[model samples]
Target: MIEVLGENFIIQQIRDFEDSQFEQTFSGIDKATSNIKNIFESLANKSCKIVRYKKFKQKILNRKPWVDHEVRDLKKTIKPKGAKLRQEPFNLELKCNFFTHAEKL
Candidate 1:
């Protein structure tokens, strides 16, 4: 039988049929807890790295404001031929279209 309470409490009712029953159950629970701890630690580390990188990128962007203007000018100057491409404000769509067309061959 399993009993769950609130958001995190889980109680399993195990009838002892042999001497090894309690040891097996507790061992399994210990292994599961260890695995969960490892996963949480890894995810936390990855998220911290992502946040650090974002902060670093924001600092760099702040230092070089003209970089954005140059990129915008470069996008306006480049255009694909043979397709009636609508004027997209961002270059992402155009880049994706270029890659898709290249993949067809």
Candidate 2:
């Protein structure tokens, strides 16, 4: 079963992070840029997830000669969106967007 409420809560957390601003600055010239690292680290620690998966032993397909950066990036972005669309098949907007992106590839 899809934990729709839990997913919505996670999405809300991401939205809140994007909506809020932090004033992370440090004193002294040498320490001026240090806070930026802390800011991003905090963001990752709070917002990102870790995944572990098992891989099957299989032969690799070599398509590097034809696939370009745009295709690679599009595939990367499409993966999670495709997963979400699967979970919420009734979401019309997401379905449309996913199909449009898939067409691009």
Q: By lDDT, who's the top model here?
A: 2
Q: What's the lDDT for all of these models?
A: 0.45, 0.71
By summed lDDT, the worst window of 10 consecutive residues in model 2 runs over 25-34
Give the per-residue lDDT digits (tens) of candidate 2, residues 18-57: 5655555434333434444554555565566767799979
TM-score of each: 0.24, 0.41
RMSD to the hidden true structure, all candidates: 15.1, 21.4
Could you tell me the C-alpha RMSD of candidate 2 in Å? Answer: 21.4
User: What would you estimate as the lDDT of candidate 1?
Assistant: 0.45
**Relative to the unseen true structure, what is the C-alpha lDDT of residue 44 in candidate 1, on a scale of 0 to 100?**
53
